[model samples]
Target: MSERPLNVGLIGGGGGAFIVQPHQRAIHFDGTRRVTVAALHPDPEVAQAEAAAWEYPLKGYDSYDDLIKQEAAKPLGERIDYALIVTPNHVHFDPAIKCVQAGIPVFCEKPLTLNIDEAKQLVDAVKEKNVPFAVSHTYLGHWTSRFARFIVKSGLLGDVRWVDSYYLQGWLAARTEDSGNAQAEWRVDPKKSGASLCGGDIGTHALMQLRYVTGLDVTRVQAHLETFVGGRSLDDHFTTYVELSNGGRGLVRASQIAIGHKNDLGIEINGTKGSLVWRQEFPEELTIRLPDQPDRTYFRGSVSANDGFLKDLPEELMAEPNIPPGHPEAFHDAFARLHRCFEQDVRAYNDGKPFECDGSKYANIDDGYMGMAFIQASVKSSQEGNVWVNMDC
Candidate 1:
């Protein structure tokens, strides 16, 4: 017989927060896992009200402390299997570390914590607790992303030379925060969003894509963080010139002031033999370019092993379920893939089995730490007149 569904507890995501909706949908995408409880808001009454008004049935708490403490005291089968922390950057470290210490697994949002020190502390806590921790670098869940990682790391593109990774958006171009936009308000505030707004928000996505697909660590960075919108304290534009571990150079850039763009995140890597490109806007396909051949585009559900240019495909990659090539698999589907992979490790943890939280299927705690380190280095590089700063992680 199949096991009972894994119970998920939310640590934030109340009061018109946009990111939570996608996460909620992803959490319940498969019947095997669910949002059984939540501490929805910072305000006690508001949190309770929101939970009561939640679209589905769930236990609610006023704060993450209550959620973690109360839920953790229950028996294994009855308590929350894992906690999903969708709080702002500043609130991340506390609840996450508490969950870790309480023997609860966590699936947290990006950029880890507000600073490198907090990130390091959280990392150390996870190590000591030995629990499953996943950082939601959502794009990595795309099948095309997995295929791209395989292509580059498999040496099909030869030794890497250069890369360009970027994410652009237009919503913050004109001070949407001033307009009382809940998402925009917290994001533009330096106190709440942490240092380097664009970098911490979406630039990390670009940084993670480069690191994930290429499997390379950024050793050093020369960065420039700028704010185009008149009175904002944090940057709306971020760019970094990075030195890769493999001796290649790359640009990881992000902008919120680009007017026409909307979530235009993409990457291009040029190696000795060829190049690979992927754009989240067109999430379905991955493109490959060889020296003298026409570009080959591979769509999800349309690949096979041992094709002329393709080598042996990993069984896990091939066997992942998807609709036919023509039918689209976009954002929510990508998120589901992440939660699905996370579920396996979570299940393993619950069963007292050895599980890998090793950056392969999803962004693990180490990956999250690297993101904070990258942000800290980029901010330092920008502040120090754009000089090269070693990523001393």
Candidate 2:
């Protein structure tokens, strides 16, 4: 028999919130999941009004606490299969922990929590409870990312030597916080955005990309978190010199003050034999460079096998959800893929089956913890005159 669609609930994402838009669209993309309820805002009246005015009928709660409390009281089939925490950096830990304690799976936005201690607490709680938890590392959903992972980890690129993982943007080049931008305002505040703004906001994405594709951990880091725009408490530019577990080296950097760059998240890896490059803006294709050969470029749906460069591509990678080459899959598609993979785990958990929270398809709780740990280490490194800090703490 075909199973019914999973009901998902939203925490936060109301009143002109940006991230939630992509999330809700992605939730609805496959018809296997739908958002049926939400605690839309921090204020009761506003939340209620937003829900009432929502495009579709939805269950509304004044706050996330009320939503979790009530839904947790319902019968299994009548309640949300999972909760999506699209709240700010400071708000992630509470609702996520609540969902786990209440026996609900959670898919949360990144940078995990405000500090390493809270991230650790969340990790321990999830482990003790044995719940399904996914951290939204959105870019990992790209089919090319998986292919890159296979190529690098399979030693197709020889021994990894250096990687340059970075995400750059021009949005916060000026003090947009003073110009009435809510996203800019909260992100620039340390109390709301954590110790490092640029690092916590987007540098972690770069780090996740490096770790995911190369299959390595940043064991040690020396960082310089800088603030280019005047009067900002948090850094707008983030740079880190990292030592990977395999004795390789790399740089995981992010900047919001770079003019003319919009969401320029990309990675280039150089190994003993050759190099591979990928850019989010041009996500459909990846470039491979080697001596005595032309640069080999592969598109998502147009990969060829038996070529000397890509001898035998994984069938599973070839089989992952995809459209034609010219159709072009972008941000929403990546988000949908993550949700789709997460849906499988949630369904398995619901049916009392063992699910994979192994950080393979989508990021697991431990990946989220590592992100926070990296941020703290970067901040400490910067504060102590840019000395190296070990990630293990």
Candidate 3:
């Protein structure tokens, strides 16, 4: 007999929130998981009304505390299998740590929490609980990302030397927050969005892409967090010169004040022998340039093993399920892939089996902590006259 579907609960995703929609779709992508309960808003009436009007049937609670307390008290199989925390930066740590303490697995949005201290606490709670925890680094779900990781880690790139990883956007080129834009409003507010705006918002995506692909950590950084837009306390443009764990140097930067660039996130890693380039705008393919050889481009669902520089493709990577080439896997597909991988770990945890919440599949608690640490370090570095700061703090 087939296994029953996993039931998911939402801590926040109402009040016209944006990230929650894609997450809900990703949760239901495989039909093996579904959202059954939610604490949609802080206001009890608003939460109930929103839940009642949700696209599907679901129970709603006034707050995450009530939801966690009630659901966690239930016997296994009767309660939500896991919780998805889709709240704002300030709201993340409380519900997430509570869920962890309640022995509920959590899939949370990125930047982990508002600051490194909260992130550290969440990390400790997760470690103590030993529950499955995943941070939603959506782009890491791309097959091309995994493929890039393989190519670089497999020694095909011949030791990484330099990297340029960036996420650029024009959305905040002006003061959109003053125009009643909820997303823009909170993001520019330091109390809600944390210390660095551009860096915490999308810079971490660029940082994670570089780390995910190169398998290297940024050890130190000299950063410049600039607020190009007047009246914003936090930065609209963030740049950092980083020292990698392997002694190589690179830049991990992001800009929200760049006009005409819409979600233009990309990475280029240059090594001693070859280089690899990938752009999220063109998610379907990755390019590799090697000296004295024709530039080789590999598309999703079309790569072959034993093709000159590419050899012995891992059976697992090759067999990982994806739509056929030309079907075009995009944003929702990437989100679904993350949820799909996360589902396996959740199921394993549910079964009391040895599960892998390793960073290989999805961003785990450690990766989340690292992101927080990176942001903290970058902010400190910028505040100290753009001086280099060690990441150990």
TM-score per candidate, chains pooled? 0.99, 0.99, 0.99
Off by over 4 Å in 3: none
Model 3 clash pairs are none
Model 3 Cα lDDT, one tens digit per residue, 116-209:
9999899999998899999999999988999999999998999899999999999999999999999999899899999989999999999999
Q: Model 3, poorest ten-residue lDDT window? A: 318-327
In candidate 1, list every pair of residues with a backbone clash: none
Q: Per-model C-alpha lDDT, please?
A: 0.94, 0.93, 0.93
Q: How far is 384's C-alpha from truth in model 1 (Å)?
A: 0.9
TM-score of 3: 0.99
Q: Which ten residues in a row have the lowest lDDT in candidate 1?
A: 316-325
Model 2, 1-393: lDDT tens per residue? 778999999999997889999999999999889999999999999999999998888999999999999999998889999999998899999999999999999999998999999999999999998899999999998888988999998888999999999999999999999999999988998889999999999999999999999999999999999999999989999999999999999999999999999999999999999999999899898999998899999999998887888788778789875578899999999999999999999899999999998988988999999999899999999999999999954
Question: Cα RMSDs of all predictions?
Answer: 0.7, 0.9, 0.8
Off by over 4 Å in 2: none
Candidate 1 deviant stretches above 4 angstroms: none
List the pairs of residues colliding in candidate 2: none
